[model samples]
Target: MASRWMWASQTIILLGAVFVLAGCEEQTNSAQETESAAVVSTPSVLASAGPVKTAEPQTPSMEQLVERYKGLELIDAHNHDASDSRYQSQLGLWKQTGLGRTVLFGDVSEPSAVGTDAVAWEAYLKYPDRVIPYFSGFDLHDPGCLQVIRGNLEKGYFGLGEIAVASTNSPVVSKVAWKANDPMDGYLPQIYDLIAEYNAPILIHLDPVGGEPLAKLEQALEEHPDTIFIFGHINAYNSPQETERLMAKHPNLYGDFFAGFTLYNPDGGGKAEPFLPVLKKYADRFMLSTDSGYGITEVRAIEAMYRVLDQLGDPVVQKNIAHDNLMKLLQAQPATQTQLKELRKQGAGGAGTEAAPQKLSKLEAGRLLAQAPKG
Candidate 1:
C-alpha cells in the first residue's frame, strides 16, 4: 500500500511540471508578439512626426496683377493739358489709374494760342509733383522763346515738345502752317545746344514725307550726339523696311507708340495687330504712350494698348513698356529732384493742388491743324 501511494504522488508531480512549462512557453510567445507590434508602430510614429515636403506656389499672370509701383512716379513722355477743366479731369484719371508722374506738353497745334512760358508755369503750379510741364518753342522766331526756354530750364521744366521741321510736302505740317524755314530750322541747332547744356531730351514730330526722315534724323544725330531725341508717333502704318532702317541707324533716337492704331490697321481705324517682333527688337528705345485727348478716357486707351501687346507672348516685355522703361528714364534725370522740392513747397501751402487742365481753345485747334505738314 505504501509503494502504490508513492507512485501516485510522483505521477501528480510530473503533471504539475508539464503545466508549468506550457505556461512559460505561452508567456514567451506573447512578449515576442507585443515587441513586433511596437517595432511596426514606431515607423508610423516617426513618419507622422517628420517634416512635410510641399511644392512652391506658382506666379500670377501680368493681367491679374495691379500696378505694383509704390509711388505716383510715372513719366508720361507724351500728354496734353490745355484747359483747367481738362487738366483736372486728366489729373483725376492719372490718380485713379495709378500714374503718379506726368509730363504735360502744352497744345502744339494751337494756331493763335501758342503755349507760352507763363502758361506752362501756371500749369506747373497746378500739380507740382504730378505734372512736369514741358515748354514748347513753337515761336522759335520769337527771340523771347529762347529766353522762355532758358528760364523754364532754370525753373525745372521737364523738356521740349513735339517740335518738327516740316518736310516739303507733309500735309500734317503744311495744314498747321508750320513752315520748314520757321524758327525750328534756325532753332534746331540752338535747341540742341540747350538740350546738351541742360542734359535734356526733346520730342520731335518725324513723319517721313518723300522718304527723307531717315536722312534728316541721321543729320540731327550727327550734329548733337549728346542730345536725346524721341521720335513722336513712329510710322505704325509705314512699310517694315522704313521702320527697320530708322531704328538701325540711330542709337540716340527713341520712338513712342501713339496714334499708330489708325495706321497699323489694314481695314482702317481700330486696334493694330501686335507689333511684338519690332517691339522686341527696339524694346529699350521704345515707349508706350497715349496721345489721348481730355475727351477720351485714359483707362480705355491704356487697356486697348495693353491688349494689342499682350498677344505678343511675353508679359515681362509688356510690363517694361507699361512702366519700367519710363521709370528708369525719369530716375536718371536730376530735374526730378528740383521738381520734388517745388512740389513740397506748393503742397505745404494747402492740402494739395488739383490736376492741370487740357482743354484746347478754337485758336489752339486751328494751330494744331495748321501745324500738320503737307504730305
Candidate 2:
C-alpha cells in the first residue's frame, strides 16, 4: 500500500510540471504575435493617410483657370497698331487670346499718321463692341496737334494717346518724346482739360526717368483732379514703392501693368511677385495690359498677361485689374451732340469730318459707314 501511494504522487508531480511548461510556451507565442502585429500596423496606418506631399505644386489646368475667370471680362487696356497693317491681325489674335475688349490706338512712332489713324478707326468700326479706339495721330511736340485731337473727339473719336509724353529711353516705340515743360507743360494741360470736359481718359507713356519726370506726372495729376491719366506700364521701371506712393496720392492717376514687356525684357525683366502687394492695395487703380512692345509674339503677350493675373490670386482683384477699372473709364457717354457742336464751334484744326482713307476695301467702307452718325 505504501509503494502504490508513492508512485501515484510522482506521476502527478511530473504531469503538473509538463502542463506548467506548455502554458508558459503558449503565453510567449501570444506575446510575440502581438508585437509582430503592432509592427505591421504602424506602416498600414501611415499608408491609409491621404495624399503625399509633392515637391512642386500642381498647376491648374487651362480649363480650370478659365472657369475661375468665367464671370469676368478680360480687357487689354494697352494695345496698338504700330503698323497700318496690324489691325485685322490684332483682332484675330485678341479673339484667340480671350480678350473681351481692347483699348486700341495708333502708333505715333509709325510715319504715316493718317494710315495709322485710319487702320485703328477701321478696326473700331468693324468691331465696335470689341475695340475702344483712342486717337494717337498727333505729334506730342506739336501743340497744334490738339486741334486735330479736338476735331477727332468732335467727330466721334474716343480719347487720346499711348502718347509718348516723356519717353527718353525707349528705343522701340518712343520715337517721339515730349519734354515736361516744368510741372505744368504747354499743350498737355489744355489737352487734359479738353478731354476732361468730354469725360475722356488719356493714356500717357511717361518714362519715370529721374525725379523730374515723375514730379511732372504727379503735378499733372494734381493739377487736373478730374482728368483720368492712365500711366502706361506702371512706368515699367518704377519701383513698387514709388508706384504705391503715386497711386496713394492721386485718385485721378491709374496704371496699366505691361505684362509682355516685363516678362520678356532681358535687361529689365521684373517678377510679378514684387508688385503684387501694391497691386492688391490699389486694386481698383491698376490694370493689366499687353503693350505689345519688345517684339513679344501675340501668344507670348497673352500668356504673360494671364500669368500676372494668376499671381494676383484674388478673383475680385483679378477682375478689377483685368477689366472693371478700364470699363469704368469707358462708361462715360459718347460726346453728346452739344459737346460735339461746341467742339466744332472751337474749330479744332482737322476737317469738319475725319477724312477716311481714299483707298478702302468695300468691307472697310461699309464698316465705317455703318458706324456713322445717322442724320
Candidate 3:
C-alpha cells in the first residue's frame, strides 16, 4: 500500500481530484430514457430455479434494496491491503459500511507485497465468498511468481491486477509503469493468454491520474480483447466522455466507478448525476467501488457510493453497478443477473430480504479481532 496513511479515510473530506472543470458537465439523462423503460418492461425471465419472490419497492431500507434486487451482493471492485492497525476491525468495518465484497490488490514492487497478499489471502480464506483476490502482474516463468499464482488459484485467487503502467512519482507505480511500456516486459502477452484461458479478469491502473497516454492501454486492450481488463477509477484522469468512448469501442474494457463523486462533487454525491446516463447505457461494463486502502477502510467510500446510487435512482442500474457486473467478472456467468431480474419483477417476498451482509456477531467479531494477525 502507498505510504499515505488515509487509505479510504472516513475522516478525510474526499473532494476528488481538484482538476474538475467548472463548466456544466454534459447531461445525457434523456438519451437512455427509452432504453431504461424497455429494460423495465422486458418481462423478467422467471425460470426453473424455484418460484421467484420479490417485495414491493417501499422506502429504500437496506433490506428493501436487497430484496428488490433479489439477493443483492454489493462488491467493491478496488481495494488495497488493510493496514495492520485496522486488520482486526476490517470485517466489522465492512459490515458497518454495507460492503459485501472487496476486490483486493497491492503494490507489486514492494518485497512486503507478498505479506500483504498473505493478509488478503487470510481474509479470503476466512470469508471465501466475500473476498476476491487478484495478484499483481509478474513474469509467468518466474518460479516464485508462478508458485504463488498457482497456489492462490487453487485457494481461489480471482485474477491479476490493479496493476498499471503509468509514469508516476510513486516508486511502486513507476515500476509497474515501466513494465507496462515494454512489450516484452515480464512477458505479459503470454501471461494474458494464460489469464484468458483461466477466464479471469485483470484490473489495470493505466494512467497515473489522467490517462492522457491512452496509446499503451489502447494497444493492450485491442490486442487482448479476450482478456477482461478493468481500468482504474472511471472518473480519474479521463472525463466521463472519454471513458464512455473507450467502453463503447472496446467490449472487453471495463471501469470501476470508484466513488470519485464523493470528493469531486460540488455537493459531494450528486456529482454522479451527469455520468448516470453513460453508466446506465453501459451498465454491464461498469462496477462500483470504494478503492479504499492504506489506513482507510471502505466506510466513507461505500456511504458515498450509495448516495450516488440514490441520486441516480434506478434499481436495475444500481444493482448492475453494485454487484451484477462483478458477478460476471467473478464467475464468468450471468445466472445470478438473470435470477435477480426475474425476482425483481416478481417482487421479492422473502428472497434476499437481508438488507446488508450478514455481520459477525459482537462476540464473533471480538474473537476474530483478537485473533487477527497483527502484521
Candidate 4:
C-alpha cells in the first residue's frame, strides 16, 4: 500500500511541471506579439511628406538684415494699395528701408472699384517720386477708357494695369466679382495699341492658371511684340524654368520676383538651386518686388522682397535687379550724386533722369537711396 501511494504522488508532480512549462511559453509569446504590434504602429517624421527641404537652419531677423544689403535700392514693379492715406503713413518706412521708389496701381478685380484708379493718381501727386502711378479701368474694353488713360499719362502716370484678364474672385462675398474673360478678347487689342503708343508698360493679371489662360497670354505677347509686358508674378506660378523659357523667347518680357516663392533659402546656406542660374542668365529681365505682399511701408515691402537676394550676397546682381534694370525699362539712367541731388527736387517730369549712368559707391549709394526719392 505504501509503495502505490508513493508512485501516484510522483506521477502528479511530473504532470504539474509540464503544465507550468506550457503556461510560461504562452506568456513569452504574448509579450513578443505586444512588442511587435507597437513597432509596426509608430511613424517617422518624413514618412508622410515625401522629401524635406534642406534649408539653412538659422535665419536673420528682418531688422538685423537692414544694413547687410548696404546699397540695395528697390523699384517695386508691382503693388496694390487702394488706401491713398498709405502714401503719407508709409513714407518714412520706405525711406528708412532703402526703397527708392515703387509702382502703385488700382486692382480692378475687386467688387468695389471705389475710385482706386483716381486714388493712385492722387498718391502720386502727393509723393510723386516715391509712388509711380498706373491707371486701372473697370473694363479695358470701355470705349471712353482710352481718354481716361491718355489723361492719366498726361497727369504723369507711369503705366496701365493690375488688369484682370482671368479672375476667380472671392466666392464668399455676396456679390459677384469681376468676370474672368479672354485676355486677348474685347477692346484689349485697341487698349494695348494705345499703351504702346504712350510708351507705357502694362501689368496683366491672368488667373485659374495653366491651360487656356497661358495660351492667351502667349498670344497677347506674340501679337503686341512692340509693347513691354511685365508678366506679373513671373511665369504665372510654375517652374522658374518656364519663366526663363518665356524670357528667352521674348525680348520685351519682364518678370516681377514676388509671390513668396523663391529659389533661395534665407539661412545663408542652401542655394535656391534653380533660381541663381536663371537670375544670372537673365539678370536684366527681372526686378525685385512684393506685389501685394505690401508691408506697412514701402521699405518694408523692399526688405521683404529683397530678403532672398540679401542671403545670396552678390552686390552687383542686387544692383542690376533692384535699380539698373528697372532704370533701363523706365528709360532713366542711373544718376550721379550731383544729378541725384537735383533729381530729389524734381518730380517725374525732371530732365536730369536722362543723364549718364554713374557707379554709385555702397556708402554713397545707400545714403542717396534713402535721400533721393525720385520716380
- Winner by TM-score: 2
lDDT of 4: 0.54
Prediction 1 global C-alpha lDDT: 0.48
Clashes of 3: 18
lDDT of each: 0.48, 0.60, 0.54, 0.54
**Residue 368 shift from truth in candidate 1, angstroms:** 34
Question: For all the candidates, what are their Cα RMSDs to the real structure?
Answer: 32.4, 28.7, 16.4, 24.8
* Candidate 1 residue-wise lDDT, 1-375, digit = tens: 010000011110101111111111222343234333433332111112111112124322222222433232434556655433245445434543445556566545223225443455555554454555665645665555577667666566657765655443444444444334432365677777776666567776654522465566678777788887777656444544566567788777777765323322332244344355666777677776555421233443343344344444465665566556655554444432333344444442122222321232212222222232334
In Å, residue 240's CA in model 2 sits off its true spot by 0.7
> After TM-score superposition, what is the CA distance of residue 184 in candidate 1 from its true location, in Å?
7.4
What is the full ranking by TM-score, best candidate first?
2, 4, 3, 1
lDDT of 4 by residue, 49-103 (tens): 1111343545554444555554666677776664443444444445445567777
Where model 3 places Cα greater than 4 Å from the true spot, the runs are 3-71, 83-87, 137-151, 169-172, 175-179, 182-184, 208-212, 261-270, 293-297, 333-375
* 255 Cα displacement, candidate 1 (Å): 0.7
Best by lDDT: 2
Off by over 4 Å in 1: 1-75, 83-85, 109-120, 142-144, 167-173, 177-184, 259-274, 293-299, 312-315, 335-375
Superposed by TM-score, candidate 4 places the C-alpha of residue 213 at a distance from the truth, in angstroms, of 1.0
Q: Per-residue lDDT of 230-308 in model 3, one digit per residue for the tens?
A: 8767665446678788889899988878664434333333356567778888988888877763223244456556655
